[model samples]
Target: MNIKKENDKEDNENVEVFDEILDKSFIESYDPSIIVENQVTTETNYGDFQHLGCYIICVLIIYEFLLLLLMGNITFLIFGAAVPNVIGCIGENKNYTFTENGCIKLYEIQKNESCIPIIENQFESIQSEYNLYCKEAENVKQTSAFLQMFAMMIGATFGGQLSDNFGRVKTIKYSLFFIIICCFLSSYATTIEVFNIYRFLGSIFVGTKSSVLHVLLLEYLPKQHRVWVSTIFSFSPNYIIFSFMAYYTKNWRDLMFVISFIGLIGLILINFVKEPVRWLIQKGKLSKARQSMIFIEKWSGKLTDNMEKKIFDYIEEESFKQEESQRRKKSYTFKHLFVTWKLTSYSLFFGYSALVGCFINYALIFNLEKVSGSIFMNTAYLGLIRWFFNISVGILDYYVKWFGRKTCHTLAMVTIILTLSIVLLNIYFPLQQQYIVRFATLFAISMCSQIFIANSVAQTELFPTSIRNIAVSFQAVFARLGSIVAPFLFGFQSYSLTLPYLIMVTMSIVDLTTIWILIPETKGDKLKDHLPNKDEWIFGKKNRELKLLKKVELEKKYGSRCN
Candidate 1:
């Protein structure tokens, strides 16, 4: 069988020789989806199992550790412990003012008087420690939350640069180290200013490590094994644990310390792992790439001599291709994402979807008080529901061929809109049963979680390896941007109860439009390692017809056996 090119004699010769080499071992050692237009993608089949356990565990622990800190702080402020009533207040004028709840309103205080704050119990929380109560204190709380998310946005950008330039594993390790130190310092903060400072510092690494580690894990796993990402990587179960811990500890400082200690597990586990082979090869570290392959072979105990030889041959070929591609173009950065029209469109579409998804996700959580239920129980329910949906979405993404990434993402948005609309219905036509209202609220938020996994997998698969982390990080930056703004709009409830849900519905519509129009069906597609060229634009209709025709021609010549 001839699998040679006809346009160029030189190319035909190269293809003939390459096909000869692949005939030896490609059928058994690699996924054939990697072959396209004479460009070979190097992927190993053995290392996924070896790398998956440690990768998932390490990411899960560290990711949940950071989220636990964020969620615990929010939960403590929203649903506080028992509050002591003030019996009396001592004035700065040496006069005593008696009042219920132990104090006079700030507005009622005389020019020469000051209200002394009094407390009965030693319940430790940000509000109690910093006296973040009253109308003016709301601004401080908002600012603190804003700063934490702002730091995260900057960290996402910085982390992507570090990952693409230095390597994913190194960036992850350094970020985790800083996170542990800052978390400890934040716990011991003596003042609000000091506490916010340490938290801001820690959040930077939180954003950094989260993006880098996720990209690393995605790179390590094969396309087929990515189902685990949505399930194990959900880490939502940690939410239930966090709720229980917060209830039992009842001290914000203790909670922070606990989360800090948990981060140590991820730090330890990551030390045992190495850089992914894909990342190593992309960066032109052929020697290191080969070493990584050997390491995986040892771990999996499945790389026979023949399989090893085939793997090395593929790696050697990919290395030569990488060198040639690099000579044609320089190293990739975030700017490259927009260099081509196709790249720009994909980047913007996914980035916008991420922003909208995250906004709706946090908005619903912040608005959880509107639902009629215990906050702790509601929080646990959110986690469990999200976990179950994560697994469901993963199975559909991997097994259900027709339910592609675009369809799944579109379904999630539709579900959110429909559920939130039900919540809206309760506003105009109040639901007699409070449980129905509560269910809609929880259901809306839980379904929105699916968007995160769907958008992430689609972005990773569609983007090339050269700028893969940057693409993911670009989306993270947008997601963090949404999170930063969510709290401010969370106050829309004060103006009108229906306003928040209305906003979410509107955003969901916008997200659904993007998915239907811009996003592609990427379920069974190969992961490209080079930047896209003309006629390969994700939204190029003409390109699709050309590809289809080419595929038909090849099928007629090679028969189905080529597949």
Candidate 2:
């Protein structure tokens, strides 16, 4: 009995020694308090109740889809659709009867300055001609177009910040309600100034919706599907709603009103979306978080204390694994974002944003006038093509993992450059038999541009969760700025298309170079693990060590009482 007791005491001492070493190493490497808090509150592996809420939220998102459709297409049509038609209307002879074919003829005449206005002595006739001319002037329409683009950018930037500070759900709901108010006001605006104000206000909500919806959808989804869901949320609704918009309204004001009504629907539906569990935890609403988790459990039909315990255990295990890997790493800081290696990633992201914004926005508009038979025909054709492209891309998204993001991006960039080159060459050297070629080139440009969808995945994976929203929004802000500028620069003069295309090509080359130099392979990587090598220690390494130490401490503190 005396010998056995001595052996047992020896074993206990050895275990204590082993634990002490682990504890010290863990504390030196990571912060234990942080790991334990994260493990208890991170809210991963949700039960079915959460998913049910997600489904309800998705239905609300459909209303968002409707609003997004209205906002994007309304701007597209105002600038691309109305400006050209108004220009054609202004140059038409006063006595010339309006006919479908005549509209095309009048447009061509206006393009060449062949149509001259007839002078009349009568005051009424002069007044009538002046009114029509004012209505159709390209300069006036162009200003409106510029305002719409500017509004989109300004709104998005401001909206993104607001959404971050307020709850995502609140930002979405309020912005949507504001959108409805703007739409109604827009419908009643008699002067150009009032119309612009309404449009600008509506644009703010439009911009807010973009980031807010993305964050909400991504947070609501399981981590595995978050990227995919974000992409779908970004692309699919624009295609569907815009296609419907094209089919519905002829008057610009009527279109604006229709869009506002859609925004109201989205606002009403906002009540259905539950605040994400992660957001609740972040806000330190533990009871609400528990209710959300239990709701998910019941809905999934997997409710049990063991299941909750297992989730807790899994989190601890992951925490320890991270700590073990990070034991030897150094810490990272915000300054690391500007260092030599990290700057490459920023440059690559900026280039990608610039290229997509300029090429897609301008190329599509230029192609409509250059390729299709008439302005109306071009609008119809481009809308249809865009619809097809979006649908095809949605399908392609499922298989994008197979091609890999870098390869897919490179392929798309190459395709866009080639197609754009052909269009630019046609512009330089007019061809008698090249109409078909021009049309084919435009279609290719639209198809190739679908690759920008990859931006959501790439940008999201490039930064840690702490800076992900800010980083993504920063890149997006630049992209929106690019979108705002491309139109005024490219579509301003009849001959300005060459300058824009040349600039786009140059941007694409830069994008490709940046992609090659930076942009590490990120396929199948987790969001938390996306930090660059330097950041791996601070955000990555220390996190792991802290977690392991906490786990050991928990066992030490709770083992005797529980056993």
Candidate 3:
């Protein structure tokens, strides 16, 4: 009886030892929580590197070659480069001549005599008809601009939602199709009324494309390279394309045709481009995610079992890691975006939009005559300078380690204000010898206002991932609304060109102040680590609950052993 009892005790002790060893191995190999935390940092090798490289090369060749071909066509080139100039010229020239105390003497070919010939009896009637037509055309253009602005906002918002619901690729594909159709329709628009309709439709698709492109680019890159890739990728092509447009086409309709051709190529390219693997994983499409991983492995060499495990574990654990507040049983309607905290962000973002719209549309257009020799030269110089500044910033973004995102944004805002203030001073004081200084300052303002890129990154990071797209789209909508209102604001005879800048500066000051007070610093931190601490005041009672839960879990796992 004693020997039998001793054997049973020994067996029980052996079983406990084996269980501990198994638990340790399990923890080392497959702890989903740890995997989730570290997945962003994990360096995984993808297999079949040579094959993958070839595939990437092929895709790039196809896309780049087609893009170049479309861009190189004379009609495409002319439309892209020339139409914006015409638009800019018309928009600016009209604003300049019609403004309070503008030099309208130059526009007056003959003071009392009409440019068109008519018999004395019909002269007054002919003049009246011409004035009516001009007024009607102006109205059409204004209405078109407003519709385009609104459509862009709505499209961007809708695109973001669609991309979140469908895949990024699908959203982009649909947007491209819309763009293509609208562009073709725009080319055929006979009257200003039809033209405006096509433009509104086109703007809608363009807005969607813009949103999708940003989201797609961010998701396609590795986490560490996301900001750099996004900054460069987003702006460089736009500048190049716009620059080309500014240099070539005279007719707006021709430009529309060029853009449509580009859209067609973009649509074709979409067939070859892979859906973002990160997005695939996020949406719980594991098979597709793994397929993406397999494709990456072909280029990067084979990933280890541990690397594969980490990726899978991170996706699974992300749901649990969602903020407790976000996971609460609250209504999921879009109106939730208007909650106090969100509203604050939205207001600031709206101000940002207003600043952009006012500066780009009204102020810049109004001030162009004071800067450049002619409309064509002005556009060329403006496009070149803008491109140079954006490219310089893109290159600098990768190297600048000291400047925080907020600091850069703040500096840009301050620069804009200072530049505009100088312009305002120039107008009031009439700097006879400082015209060059005024022009240079305006140029700098145009170049530097792009600090919004950094601001956008900061905004995207602040919101949780679930609401990120919607938040961005809503902010864009407000910005578009600001854009729509800007033309009309400056349209008033009472308002000077400087008035819009002054308003922008005031709003910018508010934006800067709010950001300094309310916005948290988000530079150089991994995205996952940047979440607001549950213990912060903003989180309220939820913080304590989360902390308590964590404590309980820690105690259950390690209490007696640590003691």
- For each candidate in turn, the TM-score is 0.77, 0.69, 0.69
lDDT (CA) per prediction = 0.70, 0.55, 0.52
**Candidate 1 on 487-546: residue-level lDDT in tens?**
677578679978877888898898888777777788866677777653354455444433
lDDT of 1 at 502: 84
Instruction: Show the colliding residue pairs in model 2.
Output: 30-546, 47-296, 48-296, 48-300, 49-295, 49-296, 50-296, 322-544, 323-544, 323-545
Better model by lDDT: candidate 1 vs candidate 3: 1
Model 1: per-residue Cα lDDT at residue 135: 41
Per-residue alpha-carbon lDDT of model 2 for 229-304, expressed as tens digits?
A: 4444543346445545644554556666666676666766777666666555444444566666666666566778
Best candidate, lDDT: 1
Q: How does model 2 fare in lDDT?
A: 0.55
* Local lDDT at 284 for model 1: 84
Error of 3 at 248 (Å): 3.4
Those runs of model 2 whose alpha carbons end farther than 4 Å from true positions after fitting are 1-81, 84-136, 223-243, 297-344, 351-355, 366-371, 374-401, 429-449, 491-497, 529-563
